[model samples]
Target chain A: SQTIHQWPATLVQPVGSPLSLECTVEGTSNPNLYWYRQAAGRGLQLLFYSVGIGQISSEVPQNLSASRPQDRQFILSSKKLLLSDSGFYLCAWSTTLNYGYTFGSGTRLTVV
Target chain B: AQTVTQSQPEMSVQEAETVTLSCTYDTSENNYYLFWYKQPPSRQMILVIRQEAYKQQNATENRFSVNFQKAAKSFSLKISDSQLGDTAMYFCAFLGDSNYQLIWGAGTKLIIKP
Candidate 1:
């Protein structure tokens, strides 16, 4: 059985603080990992996706960046967070596009 | 640019009744895929159904089914015997064969009342 773990669950930080959200998968190898953000009443926005370790493709240009330190570990980071960066962040993994993605529980970050 | 549209922002129905949610998309590419996802209070994105453009038959999963009209570029989800558990936000997504990412609609909030 495959499972994804994403943490802090929820966090509140001041603007200009550094941010790091981690996501890791268990029971799967070389799966495609993706980072997405959702704002209230808005659709999910794709931030970054990784095909392999250290191979990242970004969909949106912003203060956010992604890294795949391990085959199953994907990280989203921002050196200096902005107030507008506050939102619900989700991590998803997929073996192929024909099948739907398996998403993590998500992390809610409130930048005050 | 490709786009997905969910015309109905919200819908409400009683228990055991049937409800249909509408979705439409625009794409010049001939081969693509359509998906319907449910976001419950837990906020997990659950894939309810998926329709492949090459297939003419519609997709179904138990009480949930899709009415896919490729010519009209319309894909609608029909929920039968609706339950209170069905109350959540539903989103439609489009994935083109040549594109790596998905284009999602704003989303439709569905409320199943008792």
Candidate 2:
């Protein structure tokens, strides 16, 4: 079975600080990876998605960015965090087909 | 562009009761997929059910089922024998053949009261 691992389940960052949230999937190769953010008690918004390594398509252009450094590793990063950047970030992966996605546990970010 | 609409922002039902959450979508494509996902306080997304646009039969999983009306562009989820654990946020999502991204609805917060 495939499993997704996300680190720093909860993060507290000061404003203008750098941000890095990592996600990795085991037991799958060449999967489509995606980053989604959910505001407090709100719906999810797609931020970025990647079809393959070094290929990322951004949905909402903001301070956040995603990278697929390896086939199973995906990272969401920001050079400087903003107060608006605080939210719950999720990582998901799917196959080449339009099958549904398998999501990670998510990272809750609070920029104070 | 495809869009999903979940008009219900909140719903409440007594334990062991039944509840239906409504969802509707707009898409120009004939072949696509619709899904209902649950997010509990744990914040983990759990897939409840899915419906394929090409299929005529509605999809069901255990106590969960979907009333899919392709022509009407409606896909409602029915949860029977609801439990307190069912309290969570339910989101309706859509995926068309043209894109891999899932268009999401605003979600309906469902509460199962004891």
Candidate 3:
């Protein structure tokens, strides 16, 4: 079975601190990766999506960026975090021909 | 641009009752996909049901089913014998074939009383 692994299930970081959240998928190759954030009791906001390595399309222009250095490894980073950057971050992957998405457990980050 | 609208922000129903959540979407493309996802207190998204645009027959899985009206661009989810575990945030999403990225609506919070 295919599985996704995300690190640091929860984090509390101070404002202006650097951030790095990692996500990796196993049992799949060349999967379409995506990063999404959801506000408290709200809907999902698309941040970034990668169709292939070195190719990333950002949906929202904000304090974060995504990098797809490897086929199955995707990393989300921020140089300086803001109080508004706090939310639940999710990682998802899908096959090229398949429209169905498989999402990770998600990371709950709180900026204090 | 494609968009999804979930009119009901919150709804409540007694256990074992049947409830229908409403969803409507706007798109210019003919081929697309509609999905209903469930998020519990744990906040993990679970695919509840999906409707493909090219199909006329509605999709059903166990006690969950969808009323898909392509002409009206409306897709509503009906849960039979609703259980307390059905208490969660339900999100309606649209994915056009041109753009596979999903367009999400402000989720509806469904609370099932025991």
Please give, for residues B70-114, the per-residue lDDT of candidate 2 as tens digits. Answer: 999999999999999999999999999878899999999999999
Q: How well does chain A score by TM in each candidate? A: 0.98, 0.96, 0.97
The parts of candidate 3 lying over 4 Å away from their true place are: A96-98
Scored against the native two-chain complex, candidate 2 gets a DockQ of: 0.74
Candidate achieving the largest TM-score: 2
Please give the DockQ score of every candidate, comma-separated: 0.70, 0.74, 0.61
lDDT of 1 by residue, A1-112 (tens): 9999999799999999999999999998999999999997778999999989999999889999999999999999999999999999999998777677888999999999
lDDT of 2 by residue, A1-112 (tens): 8899998899999999999999999998899999999998789999999999999999988998888889999999999999999999999999845568989999999999
Task: Judge candidate 3 against the unseen true structure and give its global Cα lDDT, from 0 to 1.
Answer: 0.93
The residue pairs in collision within model 3 are: none
B-chain TM-scores per prediction: 0.98, 0.98, 0.99
In terms of lDDT, the poorest run of 10 residues in model 2 chain A is: A93-102
lDDT measured at residue A69 in model 1 versus the true structure, 0 to 100: 96
